[model samples]
Target: MKSHIYITRHGESQWNVECKVQGITDTPLTSKGIEQAHELAKKIKESGIKIDEILHSPLSRAADTAKIIAEENGLPLTLEPRLVEQNFGEYEGHEWKKYPGVFHEAKKQFACDYNGGESMLRLGQRIYNLLDELKVRSEKENKTFLLVTHGGIARMIHSYFNSETNEEFSSTNTGNCEIKEYVF
Candidate 1:
């Protein structure tokens, strides 16, 4: 049987507005980010989607967003370490534009470890492992899940299930607070 999964990227962080790299760096959400989380909760409620639980990244931005959504929807929230963002290593907190080649290289080589950071392939594996666990749990419990994660992880998850090529996966991106649903 297929399970319904709701996935969302965390709301905008301070680093996001500053256009800085935030991989594995803890940053709080802006006021607009809080609003976005509330909006997402409202949207889910209005749409009558039933969420059994919320699994969120441990980062502050994602945790805060998950808190709001879980509270609003009366779902239990659990922090899933595997859902954390890709570690950008030395690039964390730096301007993204300054290391254009790093991004390009990462995209080209899914196994490339960025400046001593985590590789795209490793990130994908963790996310897939979480998904596999969730799939089994959802099947046993007959429940749906809401996953709150970072943009990089979100894109990786999307690519893991949807993309047929590295180029296709690299081209995919998720906007802050954007929601994507899948039946798996």
Candidate 2:
């Protein structure tokens, strides 16, 4: 049986609007974010996509988006910690523009850790594990599901599906509630 997976990043948060880094710290969605989510719900409903189950990162932002979708679709929500954002370590709450060399540093051959946070490779492994779990679950249930996660997590998923080439797979500009369809 074939199954479809819809992946999306959470809506904008206060930190996002403030132009601050939000790796591990939890932040509430902005009013505009709530509105965007509502709009997203309407679009998904109108698209006639069949969603059987919903999974989400346990982070407040991602989980909140999943809750909204689940509430609207009358489905159960599963929290998957593996879907959480990359641990930014010491870079957790800094302003992106102010963080010198952050972009270049991330792409180094030997990925750096954010002191007290996880390394990119570590995060990638976690994401891979989560996808494996989802694949098994999808095969067993023979159903479509949605995963609500962070931009970083979304990038990891995209990279995985795209075969993890050296090409950059950045999701920094992914819009809130933007849905990506994956079929297998």
Candidate 3:
């Protein structure tokens, strides 16, 4: 049987609410984010989605979100660095929306590359590898899983499952604990 997988971006962090770029630097979730996660747990229960295992990025925000979901669903959670967000390099602490270069960079969509950091191509490959491992486990062991990761990583995951189309597939602003499901 094909496995059903769920991918989620971590709840809103202090940095996220502040409109700062939170690349590799870890941040804690806001109070609203905790509430969001709780709501997500309720949604999962209502939907009756059975998560066999949970995987998270090493980042605290992602890890905490995964932990909450796994606890609510009684599933085990593991950390996977490959699922971490793309490193922003020089742009790490800068407010991209306010910073001229960052603002300009955002408009380019897929053509833009992060300054002195991982390229989109590389980010895609990392997520692809994580999914490949998940695919093997699901196919061979018949397990379903959830992955908690960063926004950039989540975008890559969405792109992978949706296929590399010219048009970007953006997730609705998934608040803390929001669940985005994919069955394959």
Candidate 4:
């Protein structure tokens, strides 16, 4: 059988509950986030997709969620620094709603670095590179990987697999613990 790549966003974090922009700011998961991880694990197991390995961001929220899934599925996991969420710099910990204009403007200017954070182009380069490498490795080794990451990273992962419009790429975000698959 052909190999595939599976991607999932981490469960909700305390920052998420308070409507803060998580970016690369590490935060702990909420109680509901813990439950959601378990639920995601059950869903994956029931779907019967054999995950050969789990690659997770080192951020606590994503790491914790991936650990749960790894435990449930009896799969090994590796930390992937490239899978970490894009750093939002000045926007970190701020409510997204209040700063909609900044984000919207940043979306159009792909090179905008948010005064210190990774530019969209930079994020795309790393994410696309990671996916390209994974695709090659998956085909050569016949291994499937599950990437546990954050919402910003999730958007990039989807773009790696799909030809997304600029609008879609700018606006897309995955739900907490939502699993997405890409065939190799």
Candidate 5:
């Protein structure tokens, strides 16, 4: 690809403000989050990234952020099912403090599904596949992409682009609307 692919976590959501676990929970963005998206669009313009397409998670937080960016950049948005956050099942809506070591332990156990949620291995499969597909698409079309997704999904994308320790993968929490560039 002539240009790099980019990624960003959706702006702050209601759950994010409350510090709750929001795996696949359709949490909406707050007023400040809307402002953040607007600011992100400005930053993108200044960066001169020239993204060809904007892809976003189906979740409202990500979708809405993508809408703002796309409108500013004059690019079409695509709903990427593969970008969905890892389903945390019973952990949803609860504060992360309530879980204590649950998340850390669960992440280490790639096969564990959080009693009803998706396993890390499964999350890796979908995210890695999407990255591969994005690389091929970028090369075939000579285009760049911007992926709007959640923090959990961003961790997987980071792993796809770099070698990471288990600690790094489990501990990562991307800043809201901060853009990260990657090459294919």
Candidate 6:
């Protein structure tokens, strides 16, 4: 049996509003972020889709969003460390503009590491491994899942399914609380 995977980025974090890079740094969600999570829950409930489980990154922003969705849908929530955002290392908490060169390098090379941070290739592998595990589990149990994660993870997931080039993968982006579907 194939399972339908619904993936979503966490709502805007306090750092997002402040225009700071969050990369593994924890922050509370802004008011709009909370509202966005609620809206996502409403959309899922209205669609009447059955979700067997909810998995989320350990970060507060993603965890909070998962909690809301799980409570609303009466589903269990699990923390998935692999779903966390890429660690930007020394760049974390800095203004995104300050790391333009790092971002440029990432777009050009999957192995690019931002100032001692995780390489894009490693991040991709981590997520892919998680996906592989989930795919097998879902197939055996005939289960569908909802994944709550960060923007970078969401973008990576999109690239995993849709991109053929590093540029294409780098170009992918996800808005806060946006939901994307993948069939496996």
Which tens-of-lDDT digit does each residue in 67-181 have in candidate 6? Answer: 9988987889999989998997766887767666566455456676777888888988999899888899898888888999987788788876775676666667789988889
- What is candidate 1's lDDT per residue for 105-163, written digit by digit as tens? 55667777777999887887888888888888999999899999998888887875785
How high a TM-score does candidate 5 get?
Answer: 0.95
Highest lDDT against the true fold, candidate = 4
Sequence-dependent TM-score of model 2: 0.90
Stretches of candidate 3 above 4 Å error?
A: 100-113, 166-175
What Cα-based lDDT does every candidate model obtain? 0.86, 0.79, 0.76, 0.90, 0.89, 0.85
lDDT of 3 by residue, 114-173 (tens): 667776777777888888888888889888888888777777777767764443443323
> Candidate 1 lDDT (Cα, whole model)?
0.86
Model 4 quality (TM-score): 0.95
C-alpha TM-score for every candidate:
0.93, 0.90, 0.86, 0.95, 0.95, 0.92
Candidate 6: C-alpha lDDT: 0.85
Per model, state how many residue pairs clash.
0, 1, 0, 0, 0, 0
Please report, as a residue range, the 10-residue window in candidate 1 with the lowest summed lDDT: 99-108
Off by over 4 Å in 5: 1-3
Model 1 off-target regions past 4 Å?
99-102
Worst 10 residues of 3 by lDDT: 165-174
lDDT of 4 at 96: 74
RMSD of 2: 2.0
Model 4 misplaced regions, further than 4 Å: none
Order of the predicted models by lDDT, top scorer first? 4, 5, 1, 6, 2, 3
